[model samples]
Target: MKRYFIILAVLLTGCTKQLTQTNPNQQTAQTFWKTATDAVDGVNSVYGSLMLDGSYMRFTHVVLNTRGDDATSNSPWDQIYNCGKFALNVDGFAASAPFTAYYQGVFRANQVIESVPPIVMDTALKNRVLGQAYFLRGLYYFHLADIYQNVPMPLTIAQSSSDYYARQVSQDTVWMQVISDFTKAATLLPVSYADVTGLDANQFGRATKGAALAYLGKTLLFTKQYAAAAAQFQAVINLGVYSLVPNYHDNFTEQDENNPESIFEVQFSRSVGGTTQGWGPGDPQSNWAKYEARAITFGPRNFAYCDVQPTKALYYEFLQEPTAANQVDPRLYATMFYNTPTMKVYGQSFQATFGVADSEVFCRKYENDGFVASEFVWQFASGINSRLMRYADVLLMYAECLNEEGNTAQAYPYIQQVRARVGLADLATVKPNLTQAQMRDQIAHERFLEFGLEGKRFDDIRRWGWLQDPTKLAWLQARDPEFKTYTTGREYMPIPLAEIEANPGVIQNKGW
Candidate 1:
């Protein structure tokens, strides 16, 4: 299970030695890669990277959730507030933390991919491990490519110290590597590990055939290869291994992790009870901070940090579409805690708890407030698994791809599936026969509501290139005032000074 893997990661120690000396009893890189178990552990190290502070545990969600028109952050902490407004420097956690964390994932994946092949194991299991490795490497590179744009592409593990110093490459080159890795992984992965045995049993957190294919499709779609992207998404659909779960809120909480709808999610857990900003050499018997802190950071108002919330524009979008029940989109209640009358938050009426007017909006998507009496559960050890990709996302992306290809009619069915789950009116019946451009706008509206704070809005924004489009950028400026400060080249996070200082091969991104 992943619990075992996380424990194994925390328990493992770093090597320390006198100059030119080695400990004979200690396992070296030369001696470690000798068995199937080593291969499993090696790949698991990649998964462990997701739980650290820089990745899913905190900063990645911060970067992904905040820096868009959909969500707003108002942390008194400038580092937190500035990140949302695209006012980052070459320093600070916002600029560097995810950069460090994801590359750490890439490094771990590289080790597994390099070491696993010659270990003389069951062929199927070996392929599975390598497949996971490739997928994870691609996933990490995908994040790096999105955030940094132009970054180094290191396909293999370093042999010598010099090998670690990789030269920077263009974003297109990075995208090529991501597509290549995902393609290789898709070929080697299976549809499910539910029926699998041995080391990988009960490990639904691991990457699989569907995940690789979906991500590959996403990469192609992001790159504007519409036809190729459509084919990949359709291939994933043809697999029939995934579907939308009925409860939309279930996707965010710890209650239903690795469910049928989740294509890939970062695993996190709270094995120990105590939680007081737990971070040190992770203690297995004590609080080790093995939980994700995304909720606590995103937990609106008095529930947690009140650091992030829905923009007025986003809240407004939720009110535009009423479900068949004649209520405003039900997903909105699941998404945020606003000034709606009789709306209870964490078992108390909204007005009774906040004592505020109709001006403020707070997030509810990933909080533990639904189950816990207080925000204590979300403080630092919020064990909610961050769902990185889902079947719903795949459906919408497929629809977008179809619309982009001028198949506006073909896109309707996919959009209907997502809408039907939410009890919204069918587009074909209500707004019949949308043109390609109309269909594109409709899909954007759906995505904005369905995935407001789930970390997809920013990607959708960039992919649409609202920044370059005078009209769209003006609309964004209207919706989110932070866009007023956004400038050319600031869309990509600046290269951290630490990275450039450590490795001369890399250079800073423009417009820092």
Candidate 2:
């Protein structure tokens, strides 16, 4: 039987009792915290929430993807704008499993935070535990603010016996709190874990000070605190702990699964034999297997569905047409596989790549290993870690911040570093002659190409204030006219109706 972890109550009750592993000598918290190892394990449980709980995946998909102007489909989530029923509606932003999952993640993180301090331990160990909790708590709130502008921010545990109702905090307060947590986490976490040293090890996937700093910078940029954000990103550069993995493909290759560029990653270990498979169960498993460039886990016919093909807008960004040929940015081919004539796959010719005969326009190259079966069989196997944050992002963000502060000279080199790694040409000379708008566009484009579909795209579009730009929106629609008619009202997602109805304090985003 699969073990379903109940993470919600941990948030509501602020209780770690449920998270405590069993002990032979004592069945109590006191007995459990007899050593630093025990405390570390408890902290790991907090991070574990990213895995078992569905919040991370759902929030990235429905909440983030829906709010951004990037998509066109009426993906059930389209109701955030179309229906104007912010408080309650099902297909259109009404509450459902996903909303609940977000809260559950917050709850579990809070539980860890609440429980850790009380346990007596060495100061260093205690700080580490507390730091991880704060990191996770901030992460959850970051997502919350990104979606529901003003959301209830609960720092402590909520007990069922206590007041079940709490009010929402302003979005500004939420961002402030997020910054505080990430800053503290950056100070406390090690540059990297000891076991996973070097690009070859899986350690890069684990959270480090660099990852926290990168996120802190991201949050700052999203809020338009450009100068401050740039400094934080620069700090990562100063650490000298990471660098871009040369080939765009190396970043996602099985050999470089957790390369130096990755500041943090979601660790997924493959399941070899029996039910204890590393990648999770069934469909997610099959999807993992099929997407890999290696041999199909379930053969070609039984492959996983829901491939998350890129939109035509994204495809055009690559400019991989007959005239374009290799002219399309090389990164485009590295980031996404084109069924077009130039970059054919699986014996499928390019002429029919996106034509009616073959619907595979652009599949995620990062997700698809393109590894053929062989001694490379291990590459197709599970255990491939997803790079959540990378040094490249840090460099680009720093460049953006510098550009915003009119320090284009300082910024240009950083952007050039990333381009050079990918065998692309650097930006033009960056002196006082450069325009902020031009540099801004460079950073935005860099982010789009670098972080596509890794849960960063929509956030980038939304924060850029280009969410409602008619031209950009029109481009999205041009790729799929179904989106051309979408309204600006979707700027904020509807509060899932169930959540609004359940929590009186929660207000729906206006016009939702």
Candidate 3:
């Protein structure tokens, strides 16, 4: 069944207009920063680029979360099964129409960063635009690090061929650039932006000091600067506006994104009218198709794409123990949809014990639940924002840092607090003697449940130094027979050959 919605107003034309008409060199820097609306349009391009799916959209969930044998499918599924082998070439990460869309955003942000110094605007507004440019640049670099790994870091707007002929830097150097950009962003941004100052509720889901600090903390953690990461993470935790949304479901709801719990989010709105087709270029024919789960525009299956199915091991973890039966983590219900019939392979429906899956399993909580047929399908064209940072991540990082610093006893309370909000009884009531491995396992498990499909699973595994563990892979296989066997030194991803050919300095990750 194709869902349809009537558009009452003309679709938003500004995005297309700005994309076609904007040229960075034509305007004087002084004239550019004279108006708030110009700055706003510059920032809007950043938001619009997010509507297109990019490298993170695929690998973040597919290769990282679903490739393990613990993630089950027969020989038939093509999308993720290919990733399971890490056979994907660098072209797998090459420039797609979607990926290129973000470059427009980077260009727009660069215009702001370059022009602001010369513009005679109110001091506060000038600072705001500068801060936003820094934030967007940091974000673009973060994505670049994840996908390209060692691409050249171009900071200023490249006005000519001379500016474009820079040498590629090392991955470590790329991280340093990201760190510097985010650090500057933190100093320039405010706690939050007002639609108008003095009105506390007027802020959009934009960047802020907290956002920059949180991204910095995550970046530092990835780079093994644990102590420094902890300090930054602590800064966000102490900022006081953000907290865990008590109801696990509330955090993913559209109404929940800009709430006090969100530090930063990619803003999305549903059926705002007309045909914006905001979900990006995928399968327009099937985008609204009833039985096509990969459509990503409608269907409970938008949350059930073939590339990032939840692992049975993950599903099992959420099934409560005898003492805790019917006490599944509230987040489990929020993160996955388990089909009762599908799990009855042993003649016992997993749902009989776990309470889900009358027929379909959907990773539904983050998507729009109120999607009426007309509103959810492609014809209606709705959007669901991705969360870039939330307060819970800060708290968890803080606790992990404290534990790592040998204050396990002090860490116990923060860990317990997160558990309490999710309806779990405190497991570490007294912070019993715990090895670093033990504490790390608990933290990893919590993150697995907390951020199931939002695409941090692989990164977390890498950061915890668990990605290449043979024993871990074997354990995953035991949970599901399809786990692809991976060996040591196969941890870094293979750079696509096309990229290596295009830029000779680029080298692939080992064991590709």
Candidate 4:
């Protein structure tokens, strides 16, 4: 069922059709919502939007990770560089892509939520379908709130042109709505597709109770509701359905995709084929649309375009805490590639000097690594699935929440589990008897190593108030230099100009 979802997702792209109806003479969308298949299709459309360029699966990395101190965009593309430099303008693709992509998902999800309930289908299936819609709606809104800060909350499907013009809501209000949607989804979703006896077990990629709970916990964590968030993370742990993959590298490879460690991931497949009709210049294959561009963009310029490179500081971070063997953390090797003769990347020997300037170091977490071959184009066409949530992340979040709740002693084991997986010593052995502040820093350090290039750094610094603290801000600036340009009011991205133009009353984010 997971494979089916991947195939289905690859074939569908963002819905270009607008939901708002300015003219009554236009064909009623009601015509398309009358069947059970429509419900399935409606939800599938939501999933399809995940593959869009602006979605979390791809470009959002610019905002999420590139903008952080750990990485910088090496590409000449203005928008990509601006993203890493925190100099994004309202009209750039960086601002508009996420705005459009996430809302496109919200629109489709609303269609399913509003139109699917009325269809007379098998009760379990109907609720399950609706569950996914609600989950997706929550997920999209969560991204919106995280990125845009202040965004309109449009819960219902738009029935008229005016309905599209939603007024911006407070970030807190948007978060509450996110929690509401995920809470409803948790109740309706099954523990797993395997639990739904009649359904295809491959329905593995679909939203499940665990996914909803994990995300609900994540949302709560973002809001600093430590006690409540810890409870939700604990509930996911109690499910006994997920665990850290034995091999840290497996989590990033195609062979181990959707493994137990993956709670939810954006599905992609080369075999499913791209949504576009023809492969353009520098395209990997005719099926370029079916794959994610992360591998290509983050890969070494010799192997790919190498748009985003790990900062030297991130490399030094791995060296900060070595394994019991006093060797570099194993995850360092798995996460990045430098010009070491002993290192082999993408089935090719590593060379100290690559064709592109400042391309000696590259991200390895999502690089193709020649696992599947399609020539140079493989950079853009790698079918590796992008993991959105991993069990390891859950453990770290749980540890952070536990520590915040004054259970500093209890947090050790959760974080230890992550370190143990990578052959690193436990926190108790290396840094025992720590104060809450010390443990909190340990958790932050651990997360930096564990989820680099996975898009968690910017959020981590922001939530920890590091970005707001002059001392910590100086630390970041020492590493990336770009941090010097960061200002308090500029943390959230600007509202896209197009959105403001469309809704004349819409206000832009503070810094913009």
Candidate 5:
């Protein structure tokens, strides 16, 4: 699996040697967009950005999950703690990394979209490549808009240094751009690599029609276009391409990379040898680009830096309902490392190494069994694929959309499918004939349980309008005291001060 991404990394960076040798003073687009290989590499660079420190592979947790009620920045990293506590100002470290990383991706994608069409290559291949760029560009913007509601929307390649200073656009305009990109991508992308005539099986991780539709639905869902979002999600379901993996834990493991449930994922490789470059003080020579470093950041203090830890609220949430066998939700065991003597983490006893104290629960989702004492780099180089979208999420989102559309009765089976997978009773049986409001609450609970530590909770709170609701805000404050200072206009992250100074045209988010 790592070999596939390794080859992708090589194809992305190595194939553009001739283009890189052009005059340094000229614009990159003027010299670099000369061949089919350049176009391919351009889109590949966008994919490469996903593996960067500030993107989905790492700091996204700090920006999204840690800010929610489920987890906290347990390490003494002030920036991440500040983000989790809603104390982020313009100058904070958390604001800059993702803000820079996402725009880097947007810039790369913009070059691909603008430069690829005129190369006179195989038309189908060019369209496929452009489709990927569009998908990625939309994804980058989605992250930006989702985090910082007011963001600059730069659609074209930057021709000069001044072109970089884009003014902030409204959230509606950014979301429209996101929708447009994904819609264009869906039309150009094939349903799968198998559907493409000459593509190899190893190229399975590229953007596809299903991925575009799934993301499009997600964008719509986030913007409160429930009916339209449901249509897109149903289209994905109708395509018959994805399903839930039998074991939920398999979704997070390296062995199950690109599993049936994975609608879209950031591909990482431990085999792409280079220095680990991320937020941690790991082996500088470790292959960070090819690895998912969350394990190092989220694991126990002994094996890792332990930046983020699961909260007691999340722990008890799992115990709220037992399975038919009267066992704890298996997902709890898969998602966290508690003081259970039977649990083995990274091939060691969790209690012996990290202690059995009730207060010490670390994330276990990305921890692999391949780690050994001699290979300390494994801590930073876990090749586990990070899922960006899951079929389970699709089901829940669809269920939510249905309930929102005043079809609460029809939403039961979708919720039941997720619950039954974990040996829990059907939601319909437990809370039969629920009203629309009741079903909405149940879906929220299910999503929290299903997607905790996967970076979905914070988005869930935001979309549910919980952040603005006094009752919900109080509920969050009870679970995570960080919400005590969470104010109304501060829902979106502040524009980085560096960005504001550099791009004078760019306005800061409200209350920054």
Candidate 6:
């Protein structure tokens, strides 16, 4: 051993520089958050998670939209089909993918929140960075609370082995933390990035004050604090930073993303960032391209595998109300591609390429049919952004808050504003003086048509308690056969079995 040690020291005698070298490409917790760029990069990493497979990249929207009566999945994969049918394969990729993706977001956000503050940087820039961190953590938890309904709550980054396994908290406790984060974010964030002075200056997708307030409102609404929710939403409206884009379809495309209507959306690019299609929680700065797989999953047929499609009920829902011109609603044309006269898919006649079968509907909302001739062109590398919130939704939610507060009449103008955009007859003229219950039904009808296949219907129905109400559940089952399989307490996706097995403190959701 002594002889070998002497020889080894002699062999490295002239390699002292190599022995002392540190890998500049590698960044660890201890070395990160040392500069303004480092802080910006940290927050950017939190945003990066939204593009991963488990997050909005694929599974999140797929399961969220498909579980509702408005959409159905016909994939060959049983796990995909199961999620839409309200029978989530708790241990499978469909369930676990999003579970891990969201926590990955939470973990990155934790790092930003814990590490960025101590760095010396421009005061305003530092605040913006921290504000985004809080907003993102809140946003991730908002989805976590709604989708899983109950999960662990960790506000700070783990510093020790014991810190890694956060004990599960009740749904309400998670909501409270979410509320706190959003509240802090609202205070620290600017209304828009237009005036921002740092790395995110004038950026379109990073969280803004309005975005934070909107989520705060949504979280409040989700938790049934109607009055509090109303205030936050009103604050967003008061910010005066957002408005509905005249062309509704503009809200769904890569070309028109982050428009005035889009309050918050995940940024994606085909040629930038990680471009790989693998679904693991790999490094954010790795080669997994900043692209979303959802377009392929929901893309129109003939060009891509149309795993998901709009339910017939959704197709007919738009038909139930003709435009003021006594013609088919234009919004319907923008939302989906079904066989119709003179209708076109990717500039090809809808009836010519696919025979007139009204029952078969494929989503057109997020596809590149308008930009590229074929979805096959992009395939898995879809650069289309995933819109998480929009001002149009805010208007609808605010109206809901008002009606729930017994101010039914005041809710009229808000819903009416959304209707007038599409040339629908004003509600005051078509259905005047609606009672509270009548207005409630009217908003449900409006939201049904306005936000189809936007990953919002399930949350809408759940919050309205439609799934638990036997009469309402029967109504849903009548429109979607998948709803027939829905049973009590299964409204929320099951907590992943892997989570339960890995953490002794965690328990499965009730129905599973």
Computed on alpha carbons, the lDDT of every model, listed in order, comes to: 0.82, 0.58, 0.59, 0.80, 0.80, 0.84
Candidate 1 clashes between residue pairs 3 or more apart in a chain or in different chains: none
The superposed Cα distance between candidate 4 and the true structure at residue 227, in angstroms, equals: 0.4
Per-candidate RMSD, Å? 4.3, 6.4, 7.9, 5.9, 5.8, 7.1
Off by over 4 Å in 4: 1-28, 197-201, 274-288, 352-359, 372-375
Model 5 residue runs over 4 Å out of place are 1-28, 160-162, 198-202, 273-288, 354-357, 373-379
What's the residue-level lDDT of 322 in candidate 2? 20
Candidate 1 TM-score to native: 0.93
lDDT by residue (tens digit), candidate 5, 1-512 = 01111012112443333654656786455678887777776787778778777776678866888888889876687877788887876776678777777877887788788788889888888889999999999999999999988888888754454564567789999999999999999999888887565332248679889999999999999988999999999999999988888898998888888988998999877766565454422112344457777777887667677788888888889999999789999999988888787887667787777667745777888766444541255656777788898999899999999999999999999888899899998777779999999888889889888998988898888888998888989999998888898877677888877777756677787777
**Compared to the true structure, candidate 6 yields what TM-score?**
0.94
* Counted clashes in each candidate structure: 0, 17, 6, 5, 2, 8
Q: How far is candidate 2 from the true structure (C-alpha RMSD, Å)?
A: 6.4
Tens-digit lDDT string for candidate 1 (112-205): 8888888999888899999999999999999999989999877775555556568899999999999999999999988899787778976668
Instruction: Give each model a TM-score.
Output: 0.93, 0.78, 0.78, 0.90, 0.90, 0.94
lDDT of 4 by residue, 1-512 (tens): 00111112212333457575556665346677877777776787788777767775468776788877778886888878778777888877788877777877887788788888889787888898989999999999999999899898777755555564678889999999999999999999988897674343447579989999999999999999999999999999999999988889998988889899999998887778655522221112444466777777777766777778888888889888779888779898888987666677766666634422334568898766756442275545667888999989999999999999999999999999999998898779878988999998888889989998888898888878988788999999999888878877788898888677757557899978
Off by over 4 Å in 3: 1-34, 55-81, 93-105, 195-201, 278-307, 320-326, 339-361, 373-380, 477-501, 504-512
Misplaced by over 4 Å in model 1 are 1-18, 272-287
TM-score attained by model 5: 0.90
- lDDT tens readout by residue for model 2, 60-108: 3434433333322322333323322123353232234344445556665
Model 3 pairs in collision: 69-482, 69-483, 90-496, 337-361, 337-362, 340-357
Error of 2 at 492 (Å): 2.9
